[model samples]
Structure formats: C-alpha cells, structure tokens
Target: MADRLVPSISLKDFENRKGEITKQLLDAAETAGFLTLVDHGITVDEIEKQFALSKAFFDLPAKVKSKTPHDTKSNNGWEYKAQLRPSTGTYDQKESLWLQRGSQWPSDEDVPHFKDTTTEFLDKCAKVSNQVLSCLAIALNLPDDHFRVANDPNKPDCLTQLRLIHYPASENAVGTWRAGSHTDIGILTLLFQREGEDGLEICPGRESHSSFAMGDVFTPLPAHTGPIVVNIGDMLMAWSDDRLKSNFHRVRAKDVGKSPSRYSIAYFNQGRRDFVLQGPLKKYPPVTVEEYFNQAVQRNFARQQAATA
Candidate 1:
C-alpha cells in the first residue's frame, strides 16, 4: 500500500472556489484515475431514499424483475444474476437495472410513472455531470463550455446508464477476488455506493523502472457516505491526449459473516454517437466514433479471452 492517493474533495470547497478546486481535481485525475467527492451537495436523505427504492425494485419477484431482461445489444434494463460480463472466471453474482436518458418508461396502469423517481435522480445527476464537465474543460486548459457542446438538450444522445448493483456475500471468497478486472468505456463514470463491504481495489501503476515481478500495486478504497466517486473513462482519456488515465479496478466478493452484502448505483456519462471523438487539442490526430467503438470491442474481446484462459 504505497499510501493509496485517493483525492477527497469537499463540496463546500467546490462551491466556494470552483475554478481553483477544478484545477486541482484535474491535476489529480491526470495522475490518479479516481477521486472521492465530499459535500457534493446531494443530501444523505436523498441517497437513502434512492437506495430504498432500488432495494425495492431489486427485491421484486423473479417474474417481475425479469419483465425487462438484459438486452445485450441495447445494454439497457434489468440484468439478473450471471447475465452480465463475468467477473474473473465466475459470474458477477449481482442483479442490476440500467436506465438511459430519454428511454421509454414501462407503462402499466397500476405502476404508472413507475420510473418517476429514477427520472428525478437522473436530472440531479445530469446537473452534477454538467458541472463536472465544466471543471474538466478548465482542467484541460480549454474554455469552460468546450465539452458542453457535446450534449444536446433538445435531442440529446448522451447515454446515461444508471445501474443498480447488488453483490451478495460469499463464503469461499478469496482476499483479492473481484467481479472482474476491467476499465470503463465512456467519458466519465459517477459511482454512488449505497453500501459497500470493503472489497473494491484499484490497481495503480508501478514505478517506470520497476520489474515485472514487482507487479502493479493495488489499493483498497473503502466506501464513504455523501461522496460520489468519479473515475476517468477511455473516451475521456483519449480526448485528453492521454493526459488523464482510465484506471483498472475490480470488486471483490464480501466475506461471509464478516461484512454485509453490497449495493451500488453507477451512472455512466457517455458522449453522443455522432460526436467525433478526436483528441481535445489540435496536437493529436483525429479519431472517429466508429474507430473508437471498434477498438473497444477488440479490447473487450481480448480481455474476455484472457479471463477465460
């Protein structure tokens, strides 16, 4: 544990001098791919409400929860156990509900406006995301509104995935076990851990001259309340001219009896499909959406093979 350098920012600090703190955050992002945010302005009561609602949704009967089965192509809606990308050699052993911006809500007379609560949550998240994007622009030495153009309000194509994840307690779990060793594929990821059992490990890079035997160091990040964990994603890394790194992370199964089960909600903010994902500055060559998508698919497949082997 080389003094796991996770930057924790207070929301009050962000509100008082956003410009200064924004620069600091960007600097941290360039070095460490993750940061824990405090005083984020989102109330604890709100978090509790959302967590309760999520638990209720996931607690529904199998038939009800299965109504919206996981769609591989769309990558939207509920995903039952063993349906997601495998974590290491085993299944993720979690259930999740994926919600995208502007998606059609389920329509049943009794359950009318069933998605209202989720929609409200999305609105708040979007506000926070926009603020973060502004900070990112300033951090990259660009105008505050540079990335704002990427989001279209009227016909928005930005994909915002709200995933509710539940990782059960396991008796045979190893020390470093995880859902999988992977990296995110979007611009940025906003993670709200409603409850965590202390198995989330982030692998930091080793010294430049370190030997392969030394291995990349891994640091465990325990969950804290009222702080939203933000991680840089592949798209942002590419857009930043590789200045910011997208981190590699994994979630270990909780120890049986030692800790309670885990639950989290991750909101992935993605760029529009038509947005040409060229490097932010003029120094780097232009890259198209198609090219980026192809590379992501290739990388995902390679990882899958490696995991299986």
Candidate 2:
C-alpha cells in the first residue's frame, strides 16, 4: 500500500469556499483518517509569541512552575511530573500548562495585550474547530451542526484544552522509547510544532511478520512546519460507526546532543461532559453518557496494565 497524505487547505481558500472546503475535509477524513492543514490563518508572529511565553514558563524553576498545580475540576493550570500520566499508564517525561476557553480564561489585566492576543488565537481555533465539526457531520451524512446541539452555550464546560508541553533533553535517552502510545479521547486534535525538532510518530496499525514478509512497520508521515496535523479521536470514531479512525500515535525520546528537547502546543476539541455520546444518526444504536464514560475508564485501565506489565 502507498503512503497516505491528508488534505491541506490554504487560509484564503478555506474562507472562500467553506462548503467545498468542508467536502474536501470529509473526503480526507474518510480515506486517510488525518490531514495536514496549511494557511490556517494563524500568523507566524502569534505562534512565535506563544512559543516564547511557553519557553519562559518552562524555564522557570520547578518550584515556581508548580505554584498552579493541575486540578481535576477545572483541568486548567499547570502540572508537574507524575501529576499527569498517559492513559497508556506511562508517565510522560514532560511538564505542561493547560489552558481552556471559559470564564477561567487567564486574566491578563496587568500584562499588555496578553489577554487580547491569547483570546484572539483561541477564537480563531474555535472557528476552525467549528468548520471541522461541520465537515465531520457531512462525512457522517448528518446535519451540518449536528454536534453543536450537544454543546449547550449556557453551560460553559465545553472543554477546548490547549496544552503547552516541554520535554527536557536527557543524555541517556533511548531513541525508540515513547512518551506514550494511546489514542486521544476527544473529537479532533489540532497540534502546532513550536520547535523544529521531530519525534512525533503516528502509528496506523501494528504490522505482523511472516515467513515471506519483510520487516515493514507502519509509521507516521513526517509533518512540515506550516501545516497543522489533524487526527480523529475516540468519540468521533464511535459516532461515525467506525467509518473514521482513531489513530494511535507516540513521541520517541530524542538524542540529547543531536537535538534539544521538544516543545508543542496541542489543542483538543472536546465536547461537554454533560453531553451524551450516543452514535449520531440512525445507523447505529444509541449509547448513554454513563455507558460511554464507564467504557473509557475500563479502556484506560487495560492500557495501563498492559504498559506496566
């Protein structure tokens, strides 16, 4: 089989033909299960500024960074080592700050333009997410805004988690070790590469070796700087009756001297917790929120056990 590439859309073209663009997006999702977006309308300056702030935050002493610990409730604020473990059971060797779009949006009253800049970026991201959701609906042969009905505007808990992650370089790092191997538990994920270093890999599926077979393994397509890599997650896969795929991906530890640690900003487009996660449309049986939640818990537990053993 040939390597599959996702669709790429320029910013100007995306605005001009929203309908056609959405169609193309659906096509990519149905076929490749992922796509790289270009001209996403986010400016280079803004990207740089955000990265700089992330670097400054990470550079601070661990004690200072730990001031705002990760809270299970808001899921907003900072997290240190061991505070967050991957669903796969391994502890990610990085520290991160999670930001969300809500009443809890960080206050920048003292800092000049901080609030405005962050909010502007977030708003644009949300618009992009909306476009993506519309395309997902069309791909699933449902109404354009089918997913939106689940999100109640009055309750501001629709989580759009923006995670800024920084991994420190280690001298004895093994090249093939992983940050974690697991599928995301959301609708879609939008990731930005803040640094030039490459370690992220998307595994399409596991490959088996046979007597007549070569040692070929499924691997990730290398991503460029300007394009945003989009991948399907668990909720979307379930909703689509397995029409779309929830890809498994991981980050390998890089050589200490060969490359500096990696930095990335990932925006998770998630639905509100209160919303039931039934399969949309009449093609599949309906499932309740509680059922879905229990399944997720079990899946995580299994992954963790497998990882540890």
Candidate 3:
C-alpha cells in the first residue's frame, strides 16, 4: 500500500481558527477527501462506551437480531453480508445495524444504554459534521449554514443514518473484501473506529479516476482513540462543481491469515428528503432529495442479507 499523508485537523478552537481550519479542510477536500479530527468535544470514555454497547448488541442471538431485520424500503435494522458493492462485484463481509431517528432499537435490557448512549453520540456526530461543513461552505464562498440547513436530521422524512457495523473474525479469503472500493452516497460520512482496529483504505486521484482494478494503489488509515475520521462523499462532490472530490475507499484486513474481528461506528449526513439539490454554479441539474435517493437506490440496491447469522 502506498503511504499518503491524511491531514489531521484540531477542532479545539474551531470558531477562532476558521482561516487555518478552512485552509486545511479545503486542501483535504480537493485532494485527499479524508481527514482525522481531534479535540472535537466527544471524549475517549464516551467512544469506548459506545463500542461496548455495539459489541453487546452484536453478540445477541441471530433470532433476536432478526426482530429488526433490514428493510430495503426504510433502510433500518440488521443486515449481514448483504452490502454488494459495484467495485467488488460481491458482498461486503460484515454485519451492520442501521440507526435512524425512528429506527427500531433494542431494549435497554438487551443492550444496556444502547438507545441512550447512541442517541447522545449521534447528536455529537451531527455537531462535528456541521463544523466541517461550515468550513467547506466558506471555501465555496457560500453562507456557513448552507449545508447545515439542507442536512438537518431533525426534519421530517430525513434519511440521516448511524450504522454500527461488525466484521467478525474469519479466514482471510482470497479475492474477498471486507468492504469494496466505493464512494459514499451522502454528503459526508463520519467514521468512529474502535481503538487498535484498523482496515480502512482510501484511493488517490479520486476526481480523475473513473475505474479501478483490484491492484490499484491505496492508503491505509489506522484507528486510534480520541480521533474521528471524516470522508467527503458524492453529495459534496456534486454540490461543489466537482471542485471538492469524494474519494473511493474500502476495508481490508491487514492480517493475511485469520483476521481479527472489527467494529466501527459510521454516521451519514444526508440532505432532508424535501431539500432541492443543485449546485450554485449549475454544474448539475436540480433534483429533490427524494428523487436523488430513489435513483441512487435503484442504481445501487441495498441487498438485505438472507440470514442474520
């Protein structure tokens, strides 16, 4: 794997350091399309607590998890090895629990503090996302609230999502990818990985490269405590007149033998269903969030796994 430097930004004094932060963010968005954040308000204890809760939930019996089986229409609940990516042309080897505002959550008895802790964490994620989006807005010479207003999760029929995914320990099978190379559909994706669990990879030349072979070059992003990794996605790429790039990324086990199990928390910031999406420069035609979502789903169906186990 080629070693590419993914910039790290400090949100310690976000308000006072807009000039510095905005420069860092603009460079990252245009080139790397990925960055790490520190001092973003959420603490190490909070992150670890969420990891524990996720482990508890994933440890439940398959039948129990089936109570909230993944729905293709609404996109909530549990799914196993069902994420088929166009890049890999096969399923991603993992299970995930999607959490939305109205998502079916496990009881406190099933996973103590699952709902409460996650809801709290989700709000924190939103605040951090907005901070970054505000910088991007400034980079484009738009109002700071431009992206925030369109992506408010509290709005009705919003599609914002938080996913708790588990990659069970398994053989490092040849020609298999934990997550295939692909770009996110939403505006931004904030990923929280458990300490010491590392497997994410991001490719370079994202804005120019339209096709990738299995042997394409990539950079591996390691996980650690107290830092949240952020990736710009297709939504921002289009909204920025292709000036801001959304890169392709994947997850691959670093071990060549029996890979260890991995856990990750991902928050997707989506535009509200009723919001109209059109770049200020008219680079792309205007389309409502509802219309964009329907088209995206048809192009890339969220194939639910046959079984939970």
Mark the 10 consecutive residues where model 3 has the least summed lDDT: 300-309
**What is the TM-score of each predicted model, taking all chains together?**
0.86, 0.82, 0.92
Model 1, residue 139: displacement in angstroms?
1.8
Model 3, residue 129: distance off in Å is 0.7
Cα lDDT of model 1 by residue, 56-116, tens digit: 7766787777776677766787876654343465566677888676654433332434577
Candidates in order have lDDT scores of: 0.68, 0.65, 0.82
Clashing pairs in 3: none
Q: Candidate 3: misplaced stretches above 4 Å?
A: 1-4, 208-215, 301-309
TM-score winner, 1 or 2: 1
Candidate 1 local lDDT, residue 18? 89
Against the true structure, whose lDDT is highest? 3
Q: lDDT by residue for model 2 over 173-238, one digit each (tens)? A: 666444666667777888878546677776553221001121224355553455677887777777
Candidate 3 residues 254-304, lDDT tens each? 556676899999999988888887777877788887787776665554332
RMSD in Å for model 3: 3.6
